[model samples]
Target: MAELLRNYVAGKWIAGNGEGTLLTDPVTGEALARVSSDGLDLRAAFDYTRTSGGAALRGFTYAARAAQLSEVAKLLQAQRDDYYAISLANSGTTKNDSAVDIDGGIFTLSYYAKLGATLGDVHALRDGTPANLSRDQSFTSQHVLTPTRGLALFINAFNFPSWGLWEKAAPALLSGVPVIVKPATATAWLAQRMVADVVNAGILPAGALSVICGSSAGLLDQIETFDVVSFTGSAKTAAKLRAHPAFVARGARLNVEADSLNSAVLAADAEPGTAAFDLFIKEVVREMTVKSGQKCTAIRRAFVPKDHLGAAADALVARLSAVSVGNPRNESVRMGSLVSREQYDAVRAGIASLREEARLAFDGSQVRLVDADPAVAACIAPHLFVIDDASHAVRVHDVEVFGPVATLCGYEVATGNSRLEEAQAVELARRGQGSLVASVYSNDDTRLARIALELADTHGRVHAISPSVAQSHTGHGNVMPMSLHGGPGRAGGGEELGGLRALNFYHRRAAIQGPAASIDALTESTGKVEI
Candidate 1:
């Protein structure tokens, strides 16, 4: 029997009442742990966060909260080796992949800490120039960002157990809002250990951070009007969460980052064998197999000109062929298995559905494993499918396989009778309804400007790759804390990160109408003392 993982509720590390759901390793199919939040009191958790946790954080200035984050990061980083070992055994990611989550998570804390420290000892951040309420400028109004006097409820996805928690938690904690993290049950142990590390370190105040490793039963019902909920998962779950009575009736804010069909385009002028075409292929292959293509921001669609479509397909297929899949512990393994057999089955079903409109350029679901049992391992090969008809293949655009799968759409360079415009690229990219990010590879400045401007309304981030930025360019699937992440329509119409802008989600904006001299007490800057 595996150890039963405990949930940290209201400053207590407590176990569930009944037998819990078993968590197994993807590679070895061995029982690693059991997780449950059964019989936990949701009301106490909520009340503790509001009273004990919120009270501790609310008294601190922004700079003090930032200092806490820096300490927390140090504590987490010091124990990274232990976390990586757990990830290697259970999280179904390779060594480097685990670092991307564990190390990347600490980096988020550091990044936000630095951002917060620059604000000095301010309690509220002023918006813009104060508005003169009266003709003589005796009275004025100033908008400021203050911490929300409520808790943060986070529902994270399974793919990123650690990064998902910290990315949202860092901003909320820095802004003085306590956090309640509910990680997916499938990989709850990884998340549990991370919270346990912070709790054991004793850096954060009691009740400032808590983790519920099982079902969030009745928790959503406990949300108040002022609280914030940040969720990452499927669209179906997002819908159900949106309609929760507490959320709908009380006007609680919900932010979602759903898995949409993100697309990447190869420019028309960047023909076969060129650097642009080569970069597009390399990036597509990397995105398709990394974390076994479970990322919400992974490139699902690749648009190429009709003439170069064959060459692009051949290149991608060749790259996919060279990838080694099996147990991640194997020294030679280039790619690892899906998170579980259930995920493997889902990917198989998605690939079957995709085969209706697109033929497999490289099908490796039946490929032999390098260092693991094919029958027992959750190993599935990377697949590349191509749709010859780009304009009308709605299935490729609408449906996301959510695994190591991508569809190649052959698009036309000419629109109707004209051929010089770059609208064709944007048209093909927009078929995703809305996407988190789109990568456009072009050497021509005019085409880059044209496609980027056209796609701006649809995508949250448009990554235009030229030779200049390509060398140091972060790939298509990654998100930076300094950049704005989130998209319109199907991708979830909520923005999450944009330097200090992400802090706004955890903060409340107020317009105070008063004399400038009196407002100086609230804002950091000197406001008309002479008046």
Candidate 2:
């Protein structure tokens, strides 16, 4: 029997009353650990956060809070082996992927630590101009980013569990806010281990962080105006939460990075013989196999010119078919299992629905498995759908498969037609719009620039990939610590950037204008006022 992992709340380890849930190795299906919160009380957890944790965290200056983050980063670095051990229970990660998820999260903290130190000190005061008869300057005022007087709630996804928790936690903590983390049940054990090490290291204040192992019942109702709710999961759940009366009526900040129907386009100019063709094929396979295609940013839509549909689909299938799946610990296995059987079924169902407007280009469903207890391993080989849309069903466009599955949507792209599809997708994405990001490719310099510019207008950020960046992990999973990560329409219009911007999501930003003298006085500027 593996050890049972517990929750970390109010600075100590506490077991909960709920019976322990088993977590097994994705490869061997052997029990790795049992996670539970048998004695943990959600109400007490919230109370501890609101009263003690929130107050203690707020007591620190932003800089001080950042210092805590820096210390915690070092502590986590030392305990990464412990994190890795827990991580193996949920397959689909290589050493490389694990390093990015775990170390990458700590690096985000380090980045923000430098950001907080370099930004400014508290209330040395900003300068504004004098106003009123030479007494004050015009349009001069001081601006200081202040911490919101509320708590932060993070409802995370199972894939990249550690990254999902810390990437959100780091900035919120650095911003002088307390955090309540609820990890997905499938991989919550890994998060439990990581947080336990941090709390034990004593880097965070007693009330700085709290963890909940199960449901987040009744927690949202308690949130105040300045409190933040950041969620990383399905769009459907985000939509339901965004409509919560308290979020709308009280103006609470809700930032969601839900899964989107993200895409990658092949440039029309690239002939079948060119480097771009090979690049396009490689990208599709990589996105499909990485983390067993369990990423929000993974390329779900592959858009190519209608003329090249056969070639693109065949090449993609051939590449995907070659992928080896088994235990991630096996050096030969190129891909691993989905986080759970529930996820496998969801992806399978989505692929079934796609057949209404698409056909199977290649199927890996019959691929061999090495797991002794294959059912318990919860593994599903990658699946591909070739979509030829005669009539677009809302399900095909809106619902995400959430595993090693995706669709290739062919489009006719004359200069005139390209303009129409981009426009249509954006409009559709906005109303029921959903996507985290989109990329467009074209070999013709003018056409590429045109496609890139047009897509940029609609997507959060557009990547114009050529032969060079095909394998770059530059912006793969969560948003880079500095950039915004959210979609405009059905993708849920919430945002989560890594540093000060992420911090601001937890707080409110207000613009106050008045006479320069009064503004300067109000702002409490110390040096010669800039305004």
Candidate 3:
């Protein structure tokens, strides 16, 4: 029997009342651990966090909370090697992939720590300059931002267990809000260990940070109106959460990041052997292979000039063919298995759905493994499809195959009319309804700018890659803490991680209308104010 993973609740680590779900190694199909939250008193957990945790966090200034975050980052850094080992065994991620989640989590915490230090010793933030409310200027209205009097409940996805937990926790903690994380059960070991380490270190207040490793049953029922919920998962699940009574009836705050069919386009101006064309091909391959295309921002659609569609497909195939897939422990393997057999089967089914609408350009289903058995290993090779005409292929735009799969679509380019080509590309990209990001590759400054502007409304981010910034530009799928990471419409109309902008989600805004001196005193005082 595998060890049962304990849930950290109400300031103590406790085991569930029932036999838990078993977690396994994807590459070897070996049982690693078990997780369960059965029979835990969630009502008491919520009360403790709201009172003891919320009060402890709100008692500190932004700088003090920032110091705590810095300490947490240091602690994680010291144990990063352990985290890497766990990621390899359980998540089946290579060193590079592990870094994206483990190291990325620490980096985000450190970034927010430094950002919080600059906020000085204030517990409240002024929204803007005070406005005079009376003719004599004796009275004024000052908008203020303060932490909500409740905790933040995070329901993270399975793809990024470590990073997803910390990314949301960093902001909420810095904003003086408590956090209770419910990581996806498929890969919850890393998250549970990280929380246990932090709690045991006593770096954070008791109940300030908690984790429930198994079922999310009755978790939403514990939420009150003042509490906020942030989720990252499928759109179908997000819809169910939105309709929950906590949000629908009581008006609880909810932030969702759902399915996004991000795109990458090679502009008409970037002809066959140019730097822009080469860069486009390189980026698409990187996005598709990284984390086995499990990232929400991965490029699902690749658009190219109609004349160069075959050339683009050939370049992608040649590059993808060189990638080795197997167990992460194998040094020669470049790609690893999915998180589980369930995910592997889901990806294969998704590939079949895409094949119905597009022709298979490169079949990776038959690739040889590096150091793993085909029967048990959940490894999959990269697959590339080409859609001759995207206008009628409904699945090409609608379906998001969350795996190492990408479809190549062509946009017609009219002779001597670059605007028409740009417009058509935008139209094709917009078919996603909304997306996390869209990368437009073009050396032409005007064309890049025009397309980027047109794509801004439909995408949370527009990554315009030119020759000048080719070396400096980060990959399209990489979500940086300094930029926005959510999308609108079908992609979940939520926002996150725009520097200090993320703090707004955990804060409550109010306008204080009073005498000028009183307003000034309220804004300038470092003392805590009642929420």
**Highest lDDT model number:** 3
Q: Give me candidate 1's TM-score against the actual structure.
A: 0.97
Name the top TM-score candidate.
3
Ranking by lDDT: 3, 1, 2
Tens digits of lDDT, candidate 3, 102-138: 9999999999999889888988888877899999999
- Distance from true position, residue 242, model 1, in Å? 0.8
TM-score of model 3 relative to the true fold? 0.98
* Candidate 2: residue 83 lDDT (0-100): 72
Better of 2 and 3 by lDDT: 3
lDDT of 3 at 346: 95
Tens digit per residue, CA lDDT, model 2, 354-418:
76677778787788865424666667788888866412645656668888887877665556635
| Global lDDT scores for all candidate models | 0.85, 0.70, 0.92
Clashing pairs in 3: none
RMSD of candidate 3 to the truth, in angstroms, is 1.9
lDDT tens digits by residue: candidate 1, 84-179: 888877867888788777888889889999987876776667777678999998898877777898999999998888889999999999888999
Give candidate 2 regions above 4 Å deviation.
37-43, 123-143, 371-373, 389-395, 415-432, 444-446, 468-478, 512-518, 521-531
